[model samples]
Target: MPQERPVEDLTEADAKAELDRLAKAIAAADQAYHQNDAPDITDAEYDALKRRNRAIESRFPELKRDDSPSDSVGAAPADGFGKIRHEIRMLSLGNAFDDSDVTDFDARIRRYLGLPGDAPLTYTAEPKIDGLSLSLRYEAGVLVYAATRGDGETGEDVTANARTIAQIPQKLTGAPAVLEVRGEVYMTHAAFADLNANGPRTFANPRNAAAGSLRQLDAEITRARPLSFFAYAWGVVSEPLAATQFEALERLASFGFSVNPLTRLCLSPADLLTHYRRIEGDRPDLGYDIDGVVYKVNDLALQARLGFRATTPRWAIAHKFPAETAWTRLEAIDIQVGRTGALSPVARLAPVNVGGVLVSNATLHNEDYIAGRDSQGEPIRGGRDIRVGDWVQVYRAGDVIPKIADVDLTRRPADSTPYVFETTCPQCGSAAVREPGDSTHRCTGGLICPAQAVEKLKHFVSRNAFDIDGLGAKQIEMFFADDVLSIREPADIFTLARRDSSNLGKLKNRDGFGERSATKLFAAIEERRTIPLARLLFGLGIRHLGEVAAADLARHFGSWDALISTVDRASPAAERAVAADSAELVERARAADEGRRAELKKTRDAIWDDPPLPDGARTAWDDLIGIEGVGSVLAVSLVTTLSQPGERRSINRLIAELTEIQPPEARATQSPVAGKTVVFTGTLTRMTRAEAKARAEALGAKVAGSVSAKTDILVAGEAAGSKATKAEALGITVMDEDAWLALIGG
Candidate 1:
């Protein structure tokens, strides 16, 4: 219920209250589902609650309580079965909803592995059974134990029940000396129907029938109900069964264990999708229920290279079938402001079941989307707008955010009025305006708006920013609201301890803080006084200046004073260049002849080449934009943030209060490419461009995108173009990918 409060309106007190409520609610649900085996809430409802908890925790990480549900897996083992602790944690696979998601999964894998786009990679695609996960242990080619996947770490031993299953092998002739075969314990639709009809009790679905039957306290009861096992994976093994995942599955089948017949090898995303479609087409006749298709990196060596994340293996993902849809009433539309001052609309809906999940809320991207206009300004839904009290179709496919798919005009309320978007900040009554070419409207109040202020402060101390040990989002909001730590800007954070020391009200006596915690917090703040220039720049929360860009700027300038002075001097020149570019664009648009338009376009491109400014100012402007990744957009963002009188004064004050930031350490001279400016171009065959750049930088080389007189080496790959030619013309060293690799001893 506390989550019903808009995220923007949630104060520190509200967040704490909501987190406590969610923790208790989720813990109870987990107990009922995992222990009692009789869930009070639907799976979708449970997922929604967990999703809400995660969202809130992300926004207020410092407020994550000792009993935070994010850290938990499943419920504790039930009382009946003996508890077996797993040697290797049985993690879950992340889900993908559609084709784009599956593609993204592949791209992410390639990125993590540093594989080139055209590199040969293979995957094993198999049907993801909708059943309870079971793990069977074998030692010396003989069955040792069997257990359920309970909370990923510990499970309830069901060796007696598992022994009765025909698909499970009691002894293996050719298998690893020590192996733990992990798979699903499922029941076919025919078996489920027959058992439910013959037995006194009925079942909801095949998955529930399988889980309930397998988890029975009496082994005889479990055996009486038809249960089957399919070995798809393994936990602990003395040695790998095969070089590839597909081969391993085949090997499992050869060892007298049942394996899913639909499993196959996929060389690309296209192949994976083809297999998924084939499975989906045959799903109705497969006798067993399958929710999706699971894809894993085929090569065991590649799988090892791509390790695991916190909860899921990086080498695997599940592409789920589209979720079932249901109609619900649109109760209300609420505008929520984000940390960046962008206003987003959320639709509150009457609860409806969608793919076994209870759906109540969905995102309405922006005003245009709500008004039936696409991002390209094209009409959608026949230009019909969604109004409150209208019947709307809601969808929830895999991990994708729930959304309103369609509206039913037949069920529209007669009295419903067209929704009006707000033009003023809902929290601070400031003017909200949309800029040219932007889809969403933003509040102009900046630091004055409570929503923006709280968000900015949160970013200032984020993990990549100041990263103050004790000051978190929740604490920041609490202190800001109580006026005990009035951090209107980043500078105020540094001055907090000094200001609090002189005030009658102190942090040590606060409700959540004691003398020790308060003191530790101050110490944490004090320790950050002598910070790195990159972190300090990033902590300012300047738009478009991310961690990488901040580091690039810091490396380019070498010191805080140098960066500040250069940017300050370059501000005017950059603004003039931007103005000139805009004017030339306007002239091009108004030009009557093609020749004149072409000339205008050429002039626009030349504006940055020779900007109208003093000699020193022009040089500063050129250097600011000449960094490897820094471009016109980022350069303008830096100049704009630094040019604002109020923001600049605040930054200057913050700088005065702290020690000067230290430049990054010089690269070691021992490195092969130390202090060299290296440029990479064209299609790299062995590795990705990102990987090449990372390798070069690790070897103490500065990797630039373009070749210039300063470039020491140009590593050209196949199809090398202008950069390679330019490098040769400049008399700089040019080497092919293989030659470059040999030079680095790759």
Candidate 2:
């Protein structure tokens, strides 16, 4: 037999040629999968091809084409719909298969922005529908045209058909001169069934059903199809509408378009996951089909900075849910340890298709998962038991990594036997221990554990922590593995700058970085040596001492030395005095009062009924309580966390390095419109009502929910509503949104 060609050995030229070939093939496949709804290959096979192409391209960047197969849109435009040019292009999103992909996306975004690792990047998430794309255009506050996303730049025109949709307004409540909104048009499972029963032809899927309705040459036929729209994008705009995606959607609804109300705003990835879970829970109950959830960085500025790849935007990614699952043979069980030394069981399976990826393994999670088996000794509870050569169901959820979903006892091989759980760590040979409350087993090797060391190092340089430049999680793992970095403690990170770069063989050969990168990393470490006291405090990884608390500590103490002293000096009585300007403090100190000084101290501490205090103590007490948003609980946490012997020692060293650095304490500024409250009514000429509200807040004006006699100004625009009449009755001035904008000089 002929020897099989190895992909790794392919030269740059060979790789480029192969990649280009695959790109064309994949693009064709994407068109078929998305546009035609008749896939040429299964999702798993398509994913494998794409994954392989990506790997090759990553290995040889020169092989990567600008319009590679990896850059295809997931959704296709419906036929028969007319095309409309967008004012600003509506783009698609990239996808992440695992944690690594997400981290890489974040790293690139931060790098592009020239922002420090700790610089905040917020994200918003929405569901990615498996439906047809449509563009709705409004001119002079009236519905004008609706089209399909034919080729992103141009789409088919379907204006008359779109007019029949009851949810879309013929004339908006209050529309802009020229407004073009892009969203997904889909058919609900129930609606699709109803349409088929009442109409000419039955549709195969919701995507097809939506496409059929949207593409009808006759407007009446298109309107007859039970179709719904969820605005996910915009085409052209004459004026700026919203600052964020969430805000934009709200504006769409206000303009008389029926937008999906389930859209949400998530502050963090954890919160993003919460929304995903909500979608998962409601998927079956939902009327339409959703492939997965789409997440975008919430800040418009950040989104612009992130920009887009050739086909997809960098700021957004789709988290796909799994649709189909299949059974595969379980070959063996292996244990993978995490940075926290938790032993995770992995099911080694015969290569099987799940979603679009080649599934070779699945996570068992823990001992209970492995031991929970049916009467036949196969894993139960919808998961497969770890048995050698047993057939197991591998399932993928919304493009998430595949997992073992169930076991097929009927297909189990005769030679297979019940699997035995490992007693020792695979990497360190340490005894694995499972705590009573925890589901995961742990390796007792501590710092010596390779998994633990790599994980700790990764965490140390993560965006939220030290945020060392040029040190990504993968690089940290490699450096730790090569003995270039250690994970014994936080201080070890600083020592890396002193490493002998000449002797670092691994650093010389790394893909993204070389000896020059090592030098830059050293410089970055040196740069962080004199970190702000708050950052330094937060870097220590003290439990519950978040960035906010650290800033509070820094502000209250002024300097590290002051903070250390206060912590050492802090006592229960001092804490009580800080919490409450107690009366008892006055009488006891009055004995030493001179020249009626007791009265002054009482006033200073707001302790008129309490005893007198020295000027210095009063000053400290006053300074402590004066800070905004700081109260008894937080103040106590700050004092106690900094007071521990270990914490104080660590902070003392940090203080020594932070001696010259000082951050100013924040103070509440006098509001520009503090004395007067404002009420808004009717439409605004210059801005949206929401924009007016934000402006009022910025100007330090309290925006009342309704008009009252106390309303200082009411900017009423064209077609003033009942609010304007009521304001007049209450003797409150009325103004439109535009007039209000002008009044605020916005």
Candidate 3:
């Protein structure tokens, strides 16, 4: 046995350093034990290491790096999964402490764009599983490589091990020639239970069990673990998969990889919140452990445009669920001004440790959260019931800060008042508004609010927006505070290069830059002055106008000048024709006409359908459908959105300030059913089932989910299931995954 050192014997510095080293060592061991299911040390040793690391990090906050081992949340990406460098790194997200954190994140995004009040934005939320991140690569429809996500930039190779999982197809049918899919490798509660049932020792958790399985040195060992995969993302591939995040997951499932069917796409943040609440309610019923919910920009192009930050991407953020609950007395409540000028409430608690961290404050979330009453209807605190000196239960539900979950009336201090949350921006004293049916109170201060200015500036210069050089959150805040940059509005950012030279000179002297860098930054700013219409449109940070929408607008309008003139011309008439805005608006009219054309093309393109639709429809569909991945559904969506006059006018206005050129469209080969939906199912036994599907798809059929009335044909092999049954029921023809291959002349 290794001799254990007494904590009292070590110097403070030495203890901290030792703690850091131990944490790293333990994390590596966890990767080996959980991901690979191979452990180099005993459980006792691993436990000791963790205990020591926690003790040290707790005593020495300054010693912690943002990526410290103490913060490790999941298994390493599985080795044996095919590896590909990401086109854009799939970074992790920062955790939110409370409702304020979620609000702050939203505010930051808005401020970055210089969006006005009432600008609308939406988010898609999904559970953030505590599992290993694995990347799977496929070539010409066959699984090739599997690797673990290491430091985001690099990971250990683990292709053979990933092959052992059943849900992961050795070869995919009806997929592009090349593809690389990324997902989380997790263990269900039942599977983990079964794996440990006959074992001498039981697994502690799914994350641990999954880590152990994926870390196996030999692929055969990994085959025994009851590990499953749920693809939430992609690394990179030669061709596009789907336009939206929801569609992308469906595409991954079509390729025979398991995806979490629970994923949902919502139209607004309010809808997203509803889903989050539902998930919270059902968390205990879920078979896997989830620490947080990740909300991401759904459109792939928008995601790409948003890009990444140092450790996380700007397009996505994680709203952590409370992990645990604690009890403490509320000492006081403090209001803090966020970068977005939203006044957030913080409950100061008598110092109590939760989740091993000493916590003095819990987030009140918003006025609504603080003001809500219990069933008894007793003022829940000072005015609201969560008053000063009241006993409260604090929970660290995956958030950095805990939230007050309950109050103890018996222990409430006599001096406590019903807590009164404010309706004004604490920093700027601007009136705050709480819309009907909404849970949050928002500051209506807009750009004039100081707290929001710096945050907005940081967002405007974010990698996904303007992508300004040598400017970051810290720098933006400094400039705002020092009056070096009076960025009260989005347009103010365009004039930054022309600001006083002294400040610019001072910035150049900072650690990472010099005069040469300063000159280069200015040059970059000048270069961006002539941005493509789509980028400029995105940079404007218009409400609801993301990169893909911007691109669609640009393509629809063609040139910037045309878009602007049309918008300026349409504004006055738009106010009076609100109900028939689409009909009244030029863009809407074009889109509707285009949709009609697309519908006609669909009928004519159907070789398997009786009586073609029309010629005009075919031409309109041709012009509309040429863009990559713009299928029948998305094509319709694009047309429908355009049919709205106000949207068109807004897009046009944005175009006037920018110069944009739509990139060349991808040319699609003349494959059969070039615009049709086809489904293939059952056990295929000729030249490998995967090969047949790929060959058929090469001949041009729209491969799709389940056999339906709309399906052109069903490819079936021996013993097909619901898909085959449904096809026959619907009068759709069926072919074996092999005979279907033969039909395509494979």
lDDT values for all models: 0.78, 0.61, 0.59
TM-score of 1: 0.67
lDDT, residue 520, model 3 = 82
Q: Clash number for model 1?
A: 1
Write the residue-wise lDDT of candidate 2 on 1-746 in tens digits.
00101244344323433443454456666677656656666554555456556666556542334345555444346554445665555555555555456566666666555555777667767777877777788788777778666545566677887777776677876656788888888888988888778877766677777876777778778766767877777767777678877787788888777777777887656667778879978988887888678778777765654555455676787765545788888888777766556666677888976655577877565566666643344555655455777777876542223556667778878777666677788889999886654454678997678766665555445444456787766666566655444534455556555545554455456667788886787778777776666656545544334444455556545576676554445444355465344444454466465666656555545532255444344344334433322444444555665666765675454444432454533332375454355766654545445545545655656555455454677667777788688878888766555455555554
Model 2 lDDT, full chain set: 0.61
lDDT per residue (tens digit) for residues 536-574 in model 3: 544444433434445544544556555554444433322
lDDT of 1 by residue, 636-672 (tens): 8789889999989988999987876878777656877
As for lDDT, the candidate ahead, 1 or 3, is: 1
Alpha-carbon shift of residue 348 in model 2 (angstroms):
18
Clashes within 3 Å, all models in order: 1, 36, 66
Candidate number that wins on lDDT, 1 or 2: 1
How do the candidates rank by lDDT, highest first? 1, 2, 3
C-alpha TM-score for every candidate:
0.67, 0.44, 0.43
